[model samples]
Target: MAFGDASFLSRVRGFLIPIGLALLPCAIAPAFGAAALPEEVTVVAKGSGLFNIELETTVYRPEGPGPFPIVVINHGKAPGNPRFQGRYRPAIAARFFLARGYAVVVPMRQGFSKSSGSYIVGGCNVEGNGREQANDVVAALDWATAQPWADKSRILVVGQSHGGWTTLAFGTRGYPGVKGLVDFAGGLRQENCTSWQQGLISGAGNYGAQTTVPSLWFYGDNDSYWPTPTWKSMFEQYVAGGAKARMVAFGSFASDSHTMFGSPAGAPIWQPQVQAFLQEIGLPYEPQPAFAQYAADPAPVASGFAAIDETDRLPDASPAALEGYRVFLSHQNPRAFAFSAKGGWGSGWGRGDTRARALENCTKKAPEGACQLYAVDDEVVWAVKP
Candidate 1:
């Protein structure tokens, strides 16, 4: 589901090299998670009611010449324009799957970020929208399977939120080589649609009836988008239709449980579940340490400084602060640059509001004055004492 009714919604080499200078965040992946980036691939897909369009995709593989198993990770919708959704990179998922020797393929379906075509909303038909979204998935896999690095016989589809919905819908196809499906907080909840939840449930039942493969579903009580009853009913409706599925309600997580699959902290929560499920489906589950180079770097330590942008504040700064400021502007949006009186400074980059992350990192140095936001996203808010 795209974010907020309107929307919501990588590494390199022989597949490692960057696709273009424009596709990256200043050519550096955020250090908050994994410093390693992914190579971008364009998958030609028919979507947005158009004939043929290109879908932006990211591919990460272990260091080797032989073919490896494939895992296609789907992304949810982001608010506002889908064109600005940027590339989909779940750092944690990329690392976890890579450690297990599965070459990860994260695709930006038609109409997302730099991908071609517009996103198809499909009116109030949640299921129909999912089916439409699944079309792009088919195109991506068609391309991925043809690649020399891909082990076409072993494939796994995993998604979160709207991407999760797409995974479930894709399962109904019984596509060749796809062994299993994993959905984290799947489905679309449109505020404008009356009884859309039931629509989703009914659609899930329809998919369940047609689905020949097994799937694993994850939901949490603290999700701002999905309530327990709403998703539980969707699961019940699905299994009632004969789809072999297991629903894991992980209860509450951090501030919002919906963001689990993407966060590095979430690895412990979903990894074990996924590990067992992969084994049950006759897939590889043990971690392959050789793939560790593909893993994501550690996230910045949480310092509870999330709201710094709202509060105009600053700490002492040295002459070096100016250089850090330049570095801050080069990264992706939704970022923040923080400075400390103790000459400690850091920039938080990646998705979501990282103002606090920046402040927290700066705070660790025990700045002389209160650490303050020097810049946020694209704007610099620091007050230079003349």
Candidate 2:
């Protein structure tokens, strides 16, 4: 059979099984256990007409008492498949945060998972699958915040691929209490530019410009589906529009097989960065001890941008601070200039004064026009010459 035939067949099979099982509920075995059990709960969210839509959520709470920060994670496009939900469990990321203290909620959208309603994709209704999914998230947050164990003030929304697209949609609608967002390979447009198409509809308007919530967008440089240039351009537009946004590209692939975020190699690089991002925005969680150490000992800020003579100017003086500096430069939208840390008199002339000032004055040095200082978090600092 053709690919479209196969997909349609799969959907039909899934739809049939659920309907058949509903008629004979006992045929399905229970999978509930401490390991499998989430702080399970249900809520009826306001949907179209008099029919109240039922939303099923799995809540994972941290060890502490009182209210803890919350992160609402949404599943990707294959909402009806248990396998899909199983793959994107918030518990994986939740355990990391729960160790530091956070409550995670994974909700099933209408017609997907245990939630009531048919799965509508593409723009079928004003509140189709995408919007309904987003609404489920908002409602989950509402439910979580009201709980005695959740911290209403510090909430974050994280989604990957299709879920990432959902996150962007939900964010544009302006959900209250969301302070930060982590988007891993989230889709922004519906051109089938990427392979991981979830049949979800794109929201109206440019989401990049509308997103004001502080967010981090991650994609593998080699991501096969979405090209880096397109991703970067979208993010750049968002940033240009005064949105608090940051983009981090890993490897050099167009699509990192959609698993870079969860890969063993990728985890080490991204997990800490994500933790740092959360901490940077005051997410109310502790970083893992090892990751915390990494955060605490960011490579030292290099000094001596002004003392070197012109003849001795080295081509790469700011090697130690390159990464942090790059992040700073990208966010500030500074003019392009050659970067050199080598000591030299002429080295600081061509570069703008603002760049010089920002990287100067580390380790008790006076603020001079020779160098500029850029600080990252409270640990890492870098000096660049103008």
Candidate 3:
């Protein structure tokens, strides 16, 4: 729920420090652990002719030995201006893949961040821009296959926005070891450009013509960048060009559909499609406990109570707790305090079909001890210190 003015509750809340938690002087965690967090790494790739480029990469590895299947995620270009650079972190998507026992590698391509080179794309020629960026994605794939922990025979490329366009471009190359592609709102979109829409269609069709690998493309009906008709036309051209592809168009989401991939709330909407694609392609497709614990089907609401009335931080508030919370919030039938506790405790927020069911759901989430309701909607039912 929209807390609006009362959002300040976040500042006053006390943070729970797990026992043995030690503060680190560094700002971020180091990379590559089964239980440890994803690590930041530098991968040097050979781009074009003999030029070696450095990529800032984040890697999330599942808990295991030997090689794991790899899912390479490509980040999108910022809207309005390509020069408005942002940090690349695909932790949410990485978690999704990690849960499926796949190691996820997200690279900040050349020209972005400290990665070597410049971010040069066709000034107005969107197709040329995509082809250039796809080269970088392929370079990442090349580097991934060479790693000891990555399964060379099974590689998947996925991206959003510009990255999505680049992903389809990578598809056109028919890279041998890479099996599939998933594009979320993929396209190079510049609203003011004279032939922007046609450019995207032409670019997608060109890529589709050469793409041999199967692909899945998704778009929200209310995407701000490329509207429904535009993306639909591009998809038509892509498929008409003989690319084996499937398209799924979802209804409008919380905000602009373009930003869905950036939020945990969007997982329920896209994860299933991805899972089915993996299964169809003969890749491992079991849901991991790590992911299932956080999925909420019907979605949850956080309104009704004062922001202070929320005894524990909601799942959406905590990145560490987002997956479980998203699932917890999406329960089909509503429940009150499906789970809650005072003294800095929280679960997915929901008003269950019945009070008993709410309590049961909460207790089930935390079987370790008694489950209590701190609030139903916005009213405080039980009081506890932060």
Candidate 4:
């Protein structure tokens, strides 16, 4: 599914709802230690043809700067929602970058929030979405670079989901000062999704495989919409095309879903990875130990599955149930695997359980294996394996 597709939104909603439930109460607390709230602003500019354009932005700056490295974080589809934009989106990850002394800008795009202009679903191309959103991002970069507080040379563009594709589009086409690119669940290949194809058609390969900038791509193994095979192929193609690209896939959908980066689950996983990538690319920034702590800590299981008891062996479970359990086990840590019923079963069976179960049963099912009953929520995910 394309990032802009209706199905993508459904997946995003599925991922974000759980995160929102988990983190909404803690929103008031300091999500990151020593991280300060960003200063918000609305900048107005004149677009082509006397169109009044308003760009909503949140800027974070570290103390004492001789032009700090600037990272621009573009928002995903639900830009009008403040909860997702400034409070819950990739901008939150930008905070980690800011805490490390990089200047981070989260733009609301053209049509979302207080930003002016028509809404364009796929804006990578010149004519679609607001062509101005891309240009405005570049303009924001220009404004930042010119600032006495900003560094002109080191600039990074990071996007999540829709923004991920935007990062490739803008960075590959050559944003003036973009030193590096980070795509969190961003689709780089047109073949990866219809939205990417739409973008390719709209932008005319503006950010194609020819990009030479060093980039880091992240995705979730269980992202139902964009399967693992498609994501891996996209990265391989980019690497083959000479783009300095590296990809890391997380075990499950917790940090792999479309909206994962902005979630509480995502903050700890991605913040440090991005920071290290920035540092490696020569971006100026002070390192923070908090991200290290975050990395050291294991993420909590997403709340959707029933707790399983390991004392029991494979029960009268169905072939589908056993396979689901195994797939979940394959993704767990060795220590977690030792826990069997709890760890091996995974956090919970997501909407993809049906498909996952089918794949598992097809791959591993013995005529004699006891079909254990696997309870997921109120329903039996599958009846196999203890």
Candidate 5:
């Protein structure tokens, strides 16, 4: 079956592929180091507009036991009315840090998916709009640092869109363990507001004046939400107000510049800068040999299958799983095949220009006689062996 259509069976919007291999605890390093798989976790954090609320979070770290440096990933807000806010998954970004041996935390703050509370972004007046969300980030960080596996002394905060704005506000607090901040296409816009852009600049300036942490800001030339010029001005105001920061405007990326950290494809465009920033801030930037080797291997099994549902065949497309798929594709012949074994039978999928090429690749990737093609694109090529 084509992997694209198989995605429709997933309950979540992002990849649902399972990650194979057992991850070691933080204290005991694996003999053959492998990146820790991302785990969906829930943390109880005090909410601002609301009282106590549990934020939905994802954690990714190295498979070992010693405390690891932490990187909190703040998710961007979805477009449209504030009444309906969705969850943000940072699996791809988590891999980038996981490879470097850092614990990455992605939290769905209050009012967002799975997190309790109402979505409220102070209307058009736009003054201090992000402070409320910043509180969530701060609360999440507090909980993350208290975890036994996290290194509270070294923390990095990264966010996008509204989350980006939230990170900037967090920087102003000079939180003890925080080392740096990275903003990806931060800020909100309301065209109808009398002077929304100016209000954003003012907000940035206010935060910048008190921001003690070093920061990196990235924006795309084609960002629709925050135009290049407007964001540049915002950065100017931020820096002018005594914020220590560096800003980079990347070339056009994808359909919208705002999606810089939203997809796996966007990783390459921002990974280098992120790596450099980590090193600049004195955090781990290099990947261990064992983990790198693991990343280079092909993936033939689906991960994160539902424990209660035996027939849940949805594939996980998380960064680690997808990376394995990428490795397999890299070794394949022009029309190479990749097979996933499930339920004592083989389910195969491959990319090629024609049916013959696709089937050929599938068979070639499979053992000499073990693989039997069951589906090609939308067509079934073989009946059940039973």
Candidate 6:
């Protein structure tokens, strides 16, 4: 996520200038989007009609349309240049809602990925930053709800990390057809900014005070971004603001729980809770059989070349490469470490094809040699048997 220390982990947003609150209807133009995406957002300008931005969006739908219920899924801001961040969506959550007959809309707001615009961080005013981003979300929703295949009456808004903050901020304004809100590890952290945690707490209070929609929030104890105490305090502040909400403190998952929202393995942790929430809110909760076939790709099973800790047995590896392996072992599963006989080594983990990433990185170090996968998850993957 954007607020944490930069790491080998990869996680991944467009621009709007604001002068007012009057939002013109944003035109959804899937026909004019990038060849790969086939989706675009056209000038949903808010404020003084001063500026316009085209947003890239992705929509996932189930077969057979006819006014399907819809969910708006928001994405977090990643570190570095936002222009490089790929098309992002919480695929796991999208599939969950899709299986239950909800069409999912993911929008790349402002300067993220292929969207044209600059990301406005607004300095240390994180709450304001989120509120600003919510404007783009408003535009996305305006277009999404108007779709022929969408049932605007049944809408759910969900966000993770910075998007979580945006979801709550967006809730402050009661837009049309917003039934409920869900936040996963929400907040923006600026280590360089003073009292940023307090800023988030206050921001939650600000959103809660103006929000009438009931909400569900999920924060884990092991989240690297926001700690348990801070989130718990934020929850108390929101409730104290007289907003009705429920907080689920799901202890931990993976290496960092912040990533749980996007990982398919995280389903068992949040799905049941989400299902109950949907039922309570009078939305569709039953899973559809036809969509069941669209399940998430499972992680590769381990191949026992050697116990993962057997770095000493790593064939032809140099002392430096062996040390790197020790560090790689600390990361959670769904990870891979690549190395070559020439001692070129690299590792990768997180929400992408870590094996490929690892090998690609390792290859750069082994220019004259070939890099291969040596370890994956908790097992060694040396292609040749010892």
lDDT of each: 0.72, 0.50, 0.64, 0.51, 0.61, 0.73
Per-residue lDDT of candidate 2, residues 1-386 (tens digit): 11123232232111000000011111111111112213444443535457666666656654447577788877665424532343234333544565566677767666666676666554533224445456666666666777777777778888876677677667766665677778787763445334223222223225545565667778777665566665666566555654566677765531243555433234566677787777666676565452221121122333544332221343435554444334443432221122323321111111112222233223122223233233322222335434
Q: What is the lDDT of residue 73 in candidate 1?
A: 92
All predictions: root-mean-square deviation over Cα? 10.3, 19.2, 14.5, 14.5, 14.3, 10.0
**Whole-model lDDT, candidate 1?**
0.72
* Candidate order (lDDT): 6, 1, 3, 5, 4, 2
Best by TM-score: 1
Error of 6 at 184 (Å): 0.5
- On lDDT, the stronger of 1 and 4 is 1
lDDT of 6 by residue, 71-186 (tens): 88888878888898877745456557767878887878898887767998889988899898898888778777767788988888999888898998888767777777899899
Give me the runs in candidate 5 sitting further than 4 Å from their true place: 1-36, 47-50, 81-86, 125-127, 293-386
Give per-model TM-scores: 0.74, 0.56, 0.69, 0.58, 0.67, 0.72
Clashes of each: 26, 25, 24, 17, 17, 8
Q: Which candidate is the best by lDDT?
A: 6
Candidate 1 Cα RMSD (Å): 10.3
For model 2, the run of ten residues with the poorest summed lDDT = 13-22
Provide the lDDT at 216 for model 4.
80
Q: How much is 101 displaced in model 3, in angstroms?
A: 0.7
Using lDDT as the measure, name the better of candidate 3 and candidate 6: 6
Predicted candidate 4 versus true structure: per-residue lDDT over 248-277, tens digit per residue: 676574433664564534566777677666
Cα shift from native, residue 353, model 3 (Å) = 30
Cα lDDT of model 5 by residue, 100-139, tens digit? 6788877787777777677666787454668777777777
lDDT of 1 by residue, 1-386 (tens): 11112221100000000011123332323333333444444445443344658777777666686488889999998778888897876756766788788888888987898788889999999999999898878877877787778888888999999999999988877678887789999988798999988888899899887776678899999887987889999888887887777888899876678877765456678998999888776678887777656555444443443334333233544545555655665664546787754467876765432654676677666456567666655455565443
After aligning candidate 1 to the native by TM-score, how far in Å is the CA of 34 from where it should be? 6.6
Name the 10 consecutive residues with the lowest summed lDDT in model 3.
13-22
